[model samples]
Target: MKSLFLFFFLAVSAAIYAQSASTAIKPKPSYCNEPPEAYDSRKNASAVKPAALPKFNSKPVMEYRVQVAILRKTDPTKYPFHRSLVARYQPCEEVWIVESKQSFRNRQDAEKLRAELAKMGYGGAYITTLVGYE
Candidate 1:
């Protein structure tokens, strides 16, 4: 019968496929068998002492500033300033932060500058400390 012959062929094909799959070699990964030392972090600490870094106790006093606005780019023509006033342009994290003069060591000066900047069309301006060491 044709059905019996087809069933016999399928059974033989399945047996051969199963035999090939069972005989296939599987590689043993090394990470699966970690050593006992890998489990202990304290034991693997640095054997040698690290050298001491130079001291910086006598750092200079810090100052504050008024931040006008942050944009992709700044327009110097609109936000004009003299050399005495600091209009710092910091380009960081894919944007630009335009800082009003670093001349504001006190809150009063920062507030005054922020108000002036607002009148000049920079409404969202505010005061903040300098970003990092000079």
Candidate 2:
């Protein structure tokens, strides 16, 4: 009976020693191949200057409209036209575009106005689209 008790005590001691030795937390191994110099977060953030953003000078767009005339150098209003006419400066083409104030939803309406403008002695008047910036 005494020998059996000694055998049980030695078995319990071995098990307790094995569990305590294996419980220690160890550092995990890294698998990443990239260098850690680019990812360091300990540097001062304010010392690094951010890149400058590009300026948005204009937002040019093209749309269908009834073009009445194209003027250069002088103002568009100096020419003979109705009060509803609007002149838009096109920087891309470097010219002033004279068009009707009333926007047409479809191409047929713009063509009708263009025909009328042609009959009004504007022989060069035609329907065309131009990109302009405001």
- The C-alpha TM-scores of every prediction are 0.46, 0.44
- Report the CA-based lDDT of candidate 2 relative to the real structure: 0.69
lDDT of 1 by residue, 53-122 (tens): 5776564545668776565433454655534344444332334456754655577877887787787776
Give the lDDT of residue 46 in candidate 1: 88
What's the alpha carbon RMSD for model 1? 20.4
**Shift of residue 21 alpha carbon in model 2, Å:** 95
lDDT of 2 at 43: 62
lDDT per residue for candidate 2 within 58-112, as digits (tens), equals 8866555777777765566556786656898765455778888876656687788
